[model samples]
Target: IVYSWLFWYHSQLLTMKTEASVLVEVLDINDNSPVFENHPATVPVPEDHTVGDEVTSVNATDADSGFNGEVRYTLLGSAGRFSVDQETGVITLAAPLDRETQDEYRLVITAQDQGRPSHSATTTLDISVTDINDNAPIFSKQQYEATVSEHAEVRTNIIDIMATDKDDGENAIVTYHIVKQEPSSTPLAFTIDEESAH
Candidate 1:
């Protein structure tokens, strides 16, 4: 009976000798903030662009996995004039653009992850609104009066005329021409400068 008991204890020890191993990998947490792909960002928009026109696109990336890597875009201080897509990061015009009203716009764009206690990054976008011809030239004075002697030289300098245009660049360029002259039957005796408009 002692030998039998010893055999049973040996069998129990052999069964207990069988062992297995396991592996556990700790996944990365949402620790990294979103990073902008572009720097010193700038976007050009025409002043005649409509409300739905697409201006530009912004991109960002996150190192984390799953929701932590997902990015959403937002535009700050646009005053409802611009919008960014949350998923695609495409920026579009939300309102009409007029360079005459506001020549340039500075916008702050942010990219945020969807993780809990979300991390975010920001970038500045400089939107330059190009000029468009929307205003006509207006003379400074409605009428001018000048007296000259009949013996005055043929190229005598008359009163200086001035006109202004609110537009910019070539749009604001003004050229002077005598559209209508008094004493229509009389020969033309006065000329105006094209460059100085005098």
Candidate 2:
């Protein structure tokens, strides 16, 4: 919106008189929209990251003055998994994250001005959930039955047992250990390979 004003001035002298008009224009303060900087951002968060942790911050600027230039933030998507501060634009984790269930999330952040007809801008936030050692190894069967000959050699293979972990990277690496043995033999009658669980 613009307002225009006209001013008229008259000058009189002996035998001469002159008149002039001048025009001036004024612009409204709520004419500009909010703009985000460095939009379409991507952030990486560990799966074990605690809830209410600050992930990142978003910023915007408005050319208008007073309330029209004030910016507020809003977060969309992720089903309430995350939150953003309205005045600061700081994104925070609102719930626990599991990489096995969902590895990534797409969020839409909006910045709006406090004008009469508010103007808003949106940006995409790609949150990548990193791997962590949270899941334990789960065996395929609850119990195993194996029969071995009494005359078996010392290093003979007994049985192969396997377990898998849902985590990624080193967290998913499964190893085997012999915790107890039946009959309580003095020399340890059974053993398992650490790598192959045999």
Q: Which model scores highest in lDDT? A: 2
* Residue-wise C-alpha lDDT for candidate 2, range 69-172, written one tens digit per residue: 99999999977789999999999999999899999999998999999998988888899999988889999889988788999988888777889999998989
Q: What's model 1's lDDT at 45?
A: 87
Error of 1 at 3 (Å): 47
* lDDT scores of the candidates, listed in order: 0.84, 0.87
Q: What is the lDDT of candidate 1?
A: 0.84
| Candidate 1 structure quality by residue, lDDT tens digits, 28-88 | 6789999999655677788889888788888999998889899999999787899999998
Q: Compute the lDDT for candidate 2.
A: 0.87
- The total number of steric clashes, by the backbone 3 Å criterion, in model 1 comes to 0
Shift in Å, residue 107, candidate 1: 0.7
